[model samples]
Target: MTFALVRVRRGDLRLDLESFARYAGVHPDLVRRLVALGLLEPVRERGEWWFGADQLAELARIERLRRGCDLNYAAIGLVLDLLDRIAELEAELRTVRRSRPPTGGAPWTRTDSR
Candidate 1:
């Protein structure tokens, strides 16, 4: 239940649509279709699609969902949302467990031996 921190770089953090597609390990057509389906939104610069490095992870996630499941784009979004909630719940559970005291089965008792 560990989370990886994603760090964004100041400069050279942007990639064009093709580079983004390559970085995501998905097809360009799929990227276009995702944009058309509203599953992804990229910045349009001078008629070119540009994506930030932050989106690389998200795109990879989407690619995994698209390839791993038979779900449509909308369903994929729902699944991602559920997964995020599950992670949050798991973290909270860990915190609660840490705060609780350990319990033993029974207390020790001493009997008179005289």
Candidate 2:
């Protein structure tokens, strides 16, 4: 699997609920709703919720899907399920190919002299 490395600006490195809401261009209640829906996870530190660069990126993706597409949460869930199945099938195909014998014919044995 491939992972992306995000570089956060100085002030954007760590965010509380308010900062995360402002940075993600959404309302705090909406952010809370996303958290409730398992779309975003917040870090708990010293009695405060914190968000990182990855969380910001995930929020952006969710927002884009919400704005750019007509998919509701249930539809998004179905799409994610299909994508996961595709990944599993691809992995299985790779494993099956690796376990198969070579397509070339077997080497010929020496025949009796004439």
Candidate 3:
């Protein structure tokens, strides 16, 4: 529900494929593999890929899921999709709750018929 904002230095807003891989401390092949698997999405210009802060964060998240949960890439994709859906649902729920009128009692009251 909470997110941390990262500040990008001047001229560091976007990175080329090599720079992205170096910044992420991973092999270029790995990055390419992730892109192939649709795990990481980067902008392709001409014949090269350009990565932004979002890709970096997503790469870190993917690594964490892979290492922490010991899941394969396919399974990780599923987990990521589910997690994204959950986050969307949570946000919708919060918005709905905020717009709702407050009731200073139980959510439901039972009525008995004689």
Candidate 4:
């Protein structure tokens, strides 16, 4: 997959709901449902609702999981949880490997000098 870099405001980024919906290739009403489910955070401006890039990214993830894994929202949540746990474990494994010493520096000897 390709990734793009975009700049946003210092404190937070905001996009109109229409823009966010288009980015996610979903209907505005469906986006509203996701927002209602507490999975997305809405930005308010004079009673208007906007969404952030982070929220868009999350929706994209959910969409991918739904289409690729054929999972419902509940199942998606569980899969995300397990994937997060796996990532954490992988990170820990990397840290442990980095902290260990190399084992092939010296030649092996068969002498018993105890």
* Candidate achieving the largest lDDT: 3
TM-score of 4: 0.66
The C-alpha local distance difference test score for the whole of candidate 2 amounts to: 0.74
| Cα-based TM-score, every candidate | 0.59, 0.58, 0.83, 0.66
Winner on lDDT between 3 and 4 is 3
For candidate 2, write residues 35-65 as lDDT tens digits. Answer: 8877788877778778887898878777777
Q: Between prediction 2 and prediction 3, which has the larger lDDT? A: 3
Tens-digit per-residue lDDT, 1-114, candidate 4: 222222356877676777677767788898888777666778676787777777878888888999998988777777777887999999999999799886544435535442
Write the residue-wise lDDT of candidate 1 on 1-114 in tens digits: 222222245564677777777767778798898788766787776798877765787777887897888777888888888998999999999999799786443335434432
lDDT of 3 by residue, 5-113 (tens): 2335664577788888888899989999999999998877678688988899999999999999999998999999999999999999999999988765565653443
Candidate 3 Cα misplacement greater than 4 A, ranges? 1-12, 108-114
| Model 4 residue 92 lDDT score | 100
Better of 2 and 3 by TM-score: 3
Q: How many backbone overlaps does candidate 1 show?
A: 0
How do all the candidates rank in terms of TM-score, highest first? 3, 4, 1, 2
lDDT at residue 33 of model 2 (Cα atoms): 86
Quantify how close model 3 is to the true structure by its C-alpha RMSD in Å.
Answer: 6.8
